[model samples]
Target: MVIELYTYPVGFIFTFFSILSLFRLKISLTIKFGIVGNILYCLSILTSIPMMYYFTRDTPLLLLLLSRISLLIINLIYLHKLRLKKREITLEDESEIRKTILNLGTKFMRLEVREISEKCGFDRDSIIGVLKKMIINEEIYADFFQTTNTVSFDQQTNIDEIDRLMTVYKDWEKDHYEKET
Candidate 1:
């Protein structure tokens, strides 16, 4: 009785949970595949647990060929997908993503690399490294550094400066509104 309880039913439960786990968020894909592979492997151990049943010596060899082949293929495919997903830093080649990220920091004339990293969900090292490149590329600039090491964006370049820029920005907005209409 205990043996039977631990065999097909336990195997089936493992498979069921594995399938269900795919729907769960925040769990890594690698773990899901491992669960499925483990269950299929345990289930495959059933040789003759069913009374008078002969999986290996069965005359037709139906279970041996069909079940094993299908399970093996599925396991290999899932495992391969897991391996692909587990590769670190999959977005390193996508410059567009980096461009969008760069825009966040760019909005601030000057912000601490740490501040941008925290806000944008990027590491500090990556933020600073990319920021240095952006600076070199003339995509961004630091202010008030004619003789100092400080890099900061003055909130108000000048009272007059803000008013002047706001007027220009408002004019651009009106132009866009007219064009859209």
Candidate 2:
């Protein structure tokens, strides 16, 4: 197969411009138009391939235009779904953290601290301090393996002890709030 020197490079230039337009366009309508423009520009690359195959054939310009239009429509729908999925996952993560905090009676799990911070929008240092205090007070017991830097909480913590710990946390939150006001 013979290679055309200009075909791929021209296609690549159009592709780069299309990507820039997709990011730079602000208004939704303008963005949609930009996406369509990008698709049409990319479709030109595909036409170049067919142009090589049938050197003498008159390629239908309308067909290339239609293909680009269809591709743009498909991509818009896909982006909408992706945005919805991201929102749903965020809600689910928040719900999960709330449930875990309630059931565990304190946000002191070594393994889950990072996730808790993300879910609750807390700083890492604050989470570490809370966990450290819980460990120091014997409110929760965690076994740390120094060699592996791994820690696991005791699964057999008594319900009564957890209830008492949660009550203390609730009282502390009330006092903290009052102080802030």
Candidate 3:
């Protein structure tokens, strides 16, 4: 009974951290937290197995095992996704994505994220990540539509400002390259 009672609280604490980790901006931290949570969860499930079988005789052992197994599988899938996302976005990739979005934003007021992803040769997640960073940095004025997976650029955004920023950015890149070589 004691083990059964403590199992939930411990699991809940780790699970909370795992879920909270998703909100973290850094993917590395999220993955670390998720891994810890999974390990703790596995231990909890193993420890609780005897109590579960003994205390709750009405519940079939197979059913309990299957349920726990499914939960573990789900956690494994989540970790897999985290690993995929751990692929860091390089500076060159960021710059290319930024340039593509800016160029497209100039031509159209709104565009599907899929369209931008295809044009830039980056995955949808990468495009979304850059778009979010740009939005946060005040480099772009836009709103995301979840239903359609599209971004609508605000009319108030100055096209001239976009052009100026791009020009200055390209100049800096050119100078930096020249210095390096």
User: In TM-score terms, which candidate is top?
Assistant: 3
CA lDDT scores, all candidates in order: 0.53, 0.56, 0.76
Q: Can you tell me which runs of candidate 2 are displaced by over 4 Å?
A: 1-11, 14-59, 90-92, 95-181
The candidate, 1 or 2, that scores higher on TM-score is 1
**Per-model C-alpha RMSD:** 11.5, 13.3, 12.2
Per-residue lDDT of candidate 1, residues 2-61 (tens digit): 554566566566666666666774244534544555555445454333532543446434
Candidate 3, after superposition: displacement of residue 24 in Å? Answer: 34
Model 2 sits at a Cα RMSD from the real structure of: 13.3
- Alpha-carbon shift of residue 78 in model 3 (angstroms): 6.9
Using TM-score as the yardstick, the better of models 1 and 3 is 3
Best by lDDT: 3
C-alpha lDDT of candidate 3 relative to the true structure = 0.76
Q: How does candidate 3 fare on TM-score?
A: 0.47
Q: Return whichever of 2 and 3 wins on TM-score.
A: 3
- Give the per-residue lDDT of model 3 (tens digit) for 57-107: 645555655675676677678768766765568999999999998888878
